[model samples]
Target: MHKASSDTLRVSVVVPVYNRPSELRELLAALVLQSVDSAEFEVLICDDGSTVDLRAVVDEFNTMNSLQIHYFRQHNQGPGIARNLGLHNAGGAIVAFTDSDCIPEPEWLSELIGPIETSSVGMTGGLVDFRTADHLSGRCVNYLMSSMLGAGGARDPRAALHMRYYPRAGNTAVRRELACAAGGFSGQRHGEDIEFSNRILQMRTKIEFVPTAVVVHNEKKNSRQVAMEAFQKGTARIRLAREQGVHELIHTLPALLVVGLTASALTGLFLPAFSKIAGIPTVLYAIVLALIGLHGGFLLKDVRALLLLPFYASLMHIGYGAGYLYAFLTDPSTSVSLERQTVAAKSPHDGMSEQ
Candidate 1:
């Protein structure tokens, strides 16, 4: 990588962190090892009201590395708000965003920023690969996440480019000015990335998907964790669908299936004549489950993993279905007010404070 002049900071990598210190440390270490010149970029660690002060970690990195590191803190709002804070404080022309849990490849920064610099594209997103660990549950989470069904086609390069699929904030980089002009990010807990990307697209800004700029997401989610994430995502989907369009419902297929199957079963339970009819949805659900297992097994190429696929898939579907239903039934005003209440309860800190 060519080194930039001391006076010019070409890229600013912004990471919004919560309470995952170990993961944040790993991500920082990965950033320090980027092929780009240390002088060409800076890292901004935005702490979203983590209970523990992450200053020690930032201090440790600053002391050991020549790369410039900055830290800021805010009361627990969400990653979206924390990121907006980082963007406001960033000095670089290019703003790169990644999660605290992701470890970018050595060439990630260069590849992600290259398109925006060389082409008319205002934004670029990299590929995210799940890291496999020794733990079975973790591997299960990885398989589920990387699978096409699990990601709802967002990770697929073809779909991303042609299907209007938006990139996740964790692996995207944007031209700082365009990002700011697009009104930055919203305070939504989930789907904020999609909402932000949609805004950018509305401006006719080119957003490219760079497959070479890869990041390994070390997500260690157990079965329960996976279900909880699915649930949260489902609820977020309802909001997105309301704002974007009914097309957003494509991402909520599993949840819809769950709702359909459950309603069918409940109907049969209430009416004895429809008891046999209930078996129709049950069979359909079973077939879907089988397909999920097959898809997961095909991706992992591990027969043993199939044993747990059913349980994990069921939890994912059921949890998401419940959340989606709740969101669908709830009043939009009520939900928005609740979110505002949560944000209002947390006071915002002033300016950036380096740890």
Candidate 2:
């Protein structure tokens, strides 16, 4: 690709990295091959206290590619803080956000930035495709994400025309000025992107969802990893609801059903009449699981994945339910402060790789 004029750098792609050096390298490699002019865009790697020095990686890419690559290091803050730092230091007119683990397509930047450059929209988001659809756990995660059944509700872009939808930071672009005015990203351990997008929307800025600008996200979570992620996501959802009062009924439905079934089952132990009532929620849960399995199987084209769907789905529901219940029992008045305290205590994870 030809280089653009140095005076007209149009886009700056900011990525947050924790400890995934190989993934970061892969993402940078794909970025260097973008269809847009190398000089038109820059890549900023915000290192969040990774054990290894990433400056070497950034310098190596800078030496080989025509595109400008910059690196910034910070304490063990979360991706939100890292992104804010990048935004503060960015020199381009538009800021694109993606994860260290995502590989953007050749025209990803060009397509994502088109609407903002050509239309009144201030921000644009694209689709994220899994690199491989062969793994059962991976397929299950993708299914939940697409359906917005669990933590996926926060990142779902397939909302009704009248409903509000937010673009995920993993594959989104925004005008620098609008992003700055929106206060960039909140420094929460999770749900920071959703909060930021909502702030932008509240400002009356237009946001567009572009399916053509795709990125490949390599998800290789096993059953245990999926379970942990589900639990963490559930916790984050409750925290988000408590902080923003944005309750997603769809996401909470499964958890509520699970809770109801458990409560009924427990009451049945004491009262014979409640025994029969307990079966109702169980039957309903089975039907939901069946539908989820059937849909996942159809999408993955693998009946084997369907066989494992119920187990994974159950884990997700239980984890989310537990988190919701925990948050509900705790004092809502102190949730915001508690959330910040929790984030301060925990180290930043590879936020970009999450669903």
Candidate 3:
């Protein structure tokens, strides 16, 4: 709550990435250009298991940079593992995180670190923007892609509750001590951010979202690959819910809604040709499909995106719901022990009701 100096170099930027060489290059470039003082912080690019060699990019960046950027290559562990490694190596007072596909604004570090300047704070996240690319197809894709985001637009009315305005891994930061105290990230499957925050919350540390600290995210979508990612995200989200110990209903609720909506949409898609013509319900289904499609349509372009909206929605819902079911069946409540700390809960779905 106290205003702190924005130019402080107390923040450490941690970026966990996979085999996206191009995206990694883009993000590294962004890191070098940060407005925060180069001397105050260090950049850790933890490569999970890049298929291609990245030393070229790092070598090129170090040639003219004042910031000390270190590259760590680990076995093909998930992002969770990579981030944990970054946390272990980071020396900054504050820890900031972003993904390889995102471009943080010059003020990102300053803005994110500003709030955590208070001693009581533990974590903070910033606004994540799904900006449009210059191509016309890209514009359509952006709008369609982000349409499902009325969910993102819905801010927590409770100012005391941690903000989900931009609850994304690509644009979040946490204090190093708090993160270490909470158990450094590797406890989850997909939603490392959610799981990481859970440990912080358990420690009674304050986590906040600052909309002003923005990052322009490059939403990756090849026209042909949209449906597959949609399905994978759904599945990943369910696995994420289990990882964070968030109730399946709470974590997988969006997927459920999509399923319900998709069934209704499919019914409408099929009814248009029926003799009885269940016109009203079909129209209602159309409305639902259009609404949900608005989200995907903006994410994609042409007929494939539009034609596959219901399919993608179904894939996401079914995929996530199934994953949650599987995790629930196998390890309803699992613990991830690290060092002396153990991140586990018996029910994993209890608590937070009173929150």
lDDT of 1 by residue, 1-355 (tens): 1124425788889999998898888988999899998888988899999998687898889889787788888899899989887887676888899999888989999999999989899998888764344355655665555555555556545532233567779899998877877778888887788878887888899889888999877766677788888788778877877775524446657666877787787888898798887778778777766876777766666786677777787787788777787787786554342132112211112244544
Q: Give one digit per residue, the lDDT tens place, for model 3 in 144-250.
A: 33343222232221233232432456777887767776667653455556656666777877878787787766755554455444454455455545445444334
Candidate 2, 78-193: lDDT as tens digits = 88988876777666788899998788999999999999999999999888764254345665676666554433444446622122467878999998888877778877766678
| Whole-model Cα lDDT of every candidate shown, in order | 0.76, 0.74, 0.60
Clashing pairs in 2: none
Better of 2 and 3 by lDDT: 2
TM-score on alpha carbons, each prediction: 0.85, 0.85, 0.71
Q: What is the lDDT of candidate 2?
A: 0.74
lDDT top scorer: 1
Q: List runs of model 2 lying over 4 Å from the truth.
A: 1-6, 131-136, 148-154, 159-163, 272-274, 338-355
